[model samples]
Target: MHDSRAVPFVCPIDHGVLEAHGDWLVCVQCAQRYPVVGGKPVLLNEANSVFRIADYTGGNAYGGASAYGTAGDGSRGLKRLYHRIVYTLSESGAGPAAPFSASDAVAAVQAADPDAQILIIGAGETSYAGNITYTDVAFGKNVRCIADAHDLPFADGSFDLVVACAVLEHVADPARCVAEMWRVLKSDGRAYAETPFLQPVHMREYDFTRFTFLGHRRLFRFFDQIEAGISSGPGMSIAFVLRTTLANSTEHRALGAVLHLAGLVLSYPLRLLDHIFTRSNGAYDSASAHYFFGQKRETAIPDRDILQFYRGA
Candidate 1:
């Protein structure tokens, strides 16, 4: 089904239209044939995609590469499973919910045009909405194709709605990624994104940067702001920082994982405190994450004027 839905994908490197060739999407301009895995096209610009589950798993279905005598993929099966369990139990994650929440994003696209062709960036981990078409660097649980945020695989002005939740911090260059998102959107299309601010290093070395309150606005300078505010407040920030500090401070990562999970039991209760602090004036200073809901505009935001949007210098 997803293979059939992937008819409009283009090449991220050259923007060439792609046609389905057997189990692959072949680019017309470059003749680059991308393989389809599990009905989802793998359209990553790089042959070795970091998000590909197979790459990390060392060819195992359970993703336990340590058992296979591998260490370069960033995580062993036990470590990966440890993080997943902690995240699930604590309910602290970068998905389309809390901290980097998805409310504004889901609301904007659905409200503006429910039937619009929507492209969801970093959709391998979770689904943004039932009406969305998902894409990521590799086919995961629900992704429709392989796409990188820094270079999209869709044509210019091809989409009516674009949603990227908790994805910017993972990309090497946040500004270029946002620009790519703006590029794929129609003149009247809308974009919704969220990123962490006070969280600790996640996804290991892949976690590159954290933005201040104003930094998020400047990232989407080309779009008209519809709503921009804290999704996860100071309390959750305290929880995340505490738990991660405990987990990463020690040399023994497996022990650290257990320590962090135990610590999360205390932190999980702190989520409720977010209800109070999210409305505070200084939420920007300590909030865990922020969301940006904006509409695309033909005119780009002048570079010099971007400084004016800076909330913290």
Candidate 2:
């Protein structure tokens, strides 16, 4: 269980300091009560967010539900099979080697400050250190808090490192969410994110956006680039397109599953092409995904200057 007091949590609405009151956290400014479910605080601004605090407190929120399937025991076997197919399809072709190590970033931050506050937004079964706080939109086994990325429920400049890996695409407003991330980070703090570019939609309704290498850099213009490049290559993009196409070809669930598996098998060889594609500068035009690791800066990069930094062929 996380010690809430250790975290610099604030009311999402007014950004006010909160006081614990029985089973709730009351905002000192607005006096609005937010529920503490189990041990994690469901800190959502009900008016601004699509999710309601009541959804979590009432145990109605569905954590990690994808558009592909429902969360039920009866579909567990099918879901397992579907996941296996995806894993096999994505294993080899997903991308090229990453330019930087995420773990190394965590270690460097910890080395700088042993008691550093690290926040992982949309952290799904990813835990880096004891000092890190894991937050998601819904309750999960590893989630320390339920938070909306667009309006993070934490004090400004409260964290040393903020990670939003593979999360921005799912949010309705990536820019606003990124701004919230910038807002919560201390001066010269670090931000790391991985967002899809050429990938097919998997999370269904939850997936909202995609960004190219240049677009990804533009998104984090507020951060001085430390290192940014393709995390997944063109091979993975081909595999994803094939699989999604076959899977959605028909309304028949059983047949669609079989076709999806077949797509994976058919595209297996094409996925291996990433080995060559990732080495070419031209691959940036069709790269599957991009990653950005940067530090917070007071000045945003000008649009014209950002265009000059484009590496695509």
Candidate 3:
């Protein structure tokens, strides 16, 4: 980065400080080099960098690029416009979801430094569909670094804010990913994460874990709770289940697509129920996805406290 305030990154492989060595980020200790492509540091460990980059840069980036979409601007504009309305209700459920709607995460970060260094985990191109690409409004223009969420390459307490939307489930170790995010944040820093609770598996097999509303709270128990609640309502969850059931019942990919499309159309109206259902007492039990936002602290979350956070399905 040209600015002196740029967040200097460490080497994820060895956790060693790295310096700009031509077009590479060279670790001062191991002398290993991580390539910088298109101004973004490829901070992933060697094991992931090789395979993941192929998909991240190529047109089919399901390997690990959740936020980063595949190439081509083909229908992105139309997709964004459509989802802007449809997705808001389906995922949000009820009145308003916390953390995901969370300007608080940004507020907490901005409180420390107006030009705070915020890091977005799994920041990459939009998905293969381009519908989920990064919005400049949410992630401000100051975000200058891009790296793997699981293995962040930054000195301890370097960032003011970290946001991971729909990313934890993709990583093999969500705990490790959270810990890494914590490690990079300043004590006053905050983090926001979102994950599905009842939604079907997505992003191929890369999709892994789903958490209860309370389970989501416990995920970031290490931090002081700013807010956490349903990001996507239960209506969307039921819709996905319907789509999944129909898709699995048939072997024909084309027919499966038709069924899923039809399911979504029928289900689209169901989300209106979320305005009531998401606010119901059983909302957490049937939530489509959840969001958690909190601030970092010095004390560790107690194991005993964690055990008691479940609200159940």
Best-matching candidate per TM-score: 2
> Considering TM-score, where higher is better, how would the candidates rank from best to worst?
2, 1, 3
- For each candidate in the order shown, give its overall lDDT on alpha carbons: 0.71, 0.82, 0.65
What global local distance difference test value does model 1 have? 0.71
State residue 216's C-alpha deviation in candidate 1, in Å. 0.8
| lDDT by residue (tens digit), candidate 3, 1-313 | 2223666678877789888978777899988776665566556674643235434344442324423332322456856654454444333444344434535566555555567776766554322211111211112122334455667777889777777877877777788889888998888878888888888887677677987877777778779877777777777778778867876778998677566656666776676677777666577888888888888988877868876655544
> Please, what are the lDDT tens digits per residue for candidate 1 over residues 1-313?
2222332778877999888878778899999877776676666676433454344224432222112222223676877676567647666443223443465566656676655677778764565554567776544566676677877888899887788877898888888888888888888888888788999877666678998877788888889977777777788889888787877778996788677887787677677677766665677887788888889877778878876665431
The per-candidate count of clashes, in order, stands at 1, 2, 8
lDDT of 3 at 188: 81
Backbone clash pairs for candidate 2 read 95-232, 95-233
Which pairs of residues clash in candidate 3, taking residues 3 or more apart in a chain or in different chains?
68-124, 68-125, 68-126, 69-125, 69-126, 69-127, 70-127, 91-232
Q: Is candidate 1 or candidate 3 better by TM-score?
A: 1
Residue 239 alpha-carbon offset, candidate 3, angstroms: 1.0
Give lDDT tens digits, candidate 2, residues 1-313: 4433356689998799999999899999999888898988899987767788888877787566322222332445867877755665655433446766567668878887777788989886676764888899866667888899988998899888899888989988999999999999999799989899999986667788999899999999999988888888888888889888998999999899788888988877766788888888988999888888899999999999999768877
Question: Which pairs of residues collide in candidate 1?
Answer: 136-147
